[model samples]
Target: MGIFGFFILAAAGYFLYRNYFTTNTYETKDERYNAARAQRQKELDGLLDKINRRGMSSLSERERQRLDELSGK
Candidate 1:
């Protein structure tokens, strides 16, 4: 019974620590949005470069779908 109580207390403490003490990678909504936009643009550029070098046929089905998504098709 004592060991079980200790385990419950430790679990609750861990939950509180994780929920209240963890720091987010981005500090604000605008910063997070900009970072995501930059990453998407970088990926789009790489995909376009691949197509330019190897032709659109070289893109796998997944890559083609990703291109459509990034280009807002």
Candidate 2:
């Protein structure tokens, strides 16, 4: 290829790589909050399952407090 053609191909490749391979992490405050809430929900579900199988008495004090805090009580 000619020099001009080579530079054109290089620029196109650079732009394509930047668009498709770069990480996008531009979360708004609400989006970040929702993601955190989802994670907490997953954790709470696991804890609740443990309580169901083993009874509430099986939960450590820290785990029970976390449950109360998460349940908004």
Candidate 3:
């Protein structure tokens, strides 16, 4: 029973650590930049969808500039 209790407590602690204490640690600048670029691409895709459904006018100035910057236009 003591061994079982220790295993249960260890499992719980492991889960808590994973859920609350883990941090993203990139190994290199390129890795971080690629992650950021992918996130921006996701955002740009969402904006493009919005533009398709509505129009360019639907985008705020900040969003439009972001789109242009991402597209290198």
Candidate 4:
């Protein structure tokens, strides 16, 4: 095989390996925002559930602080 052919194949293999092995690469800002939003939504759901079942007034001081933080107060 010609040197040029070997070089082309090696370049393709390197690219394939890099693509397969690289950690997550965010493609757009929206992707990053969505991930953070999902996490926050999950946290809010759990917090709301606790408040509902236990009563907001019954929550401990720490739980109240968490709720306030989630509400951005």
- Highest lDDT: give the candidate number: 1
Please report, in order, the local distance difference test score of every candidate based on alpha carbons: 0.94, 0.93, 0.91, 0.85
TM-score of each: 0.65, 0.67, 0.58, 0.58
- Candidate number with greatest TM-score: 2
Clashing pairs in 4: none
Residue 69, model 1: lDDT of 100
Write candidate 3's Cα lDDT for 1-73 as tens digits. 6999999999999998987789555369888889898998999899999999999999999998989998999
Task: Tell me the tens digit of each residue's lDDT in model 1 across 1-73.
Answer: 6999999999999998887778554469888889999999999999999999999999999999999999999
Off by over 4 Å in 4: 1-24
The global Cα lDDT (0 to 1) of model 3 is: 0.91
Cα shift from native, residue 28, model 2 (Å): 1.4
Report the C-alpha lDDT of model 2 over 1-73, residue by residue, as the tens digit.
8999999999999998898789586789999999999999998998999999999999999999999988889
Q: Show where candidate 1 strays beyond 4 Å.
A: 1-26
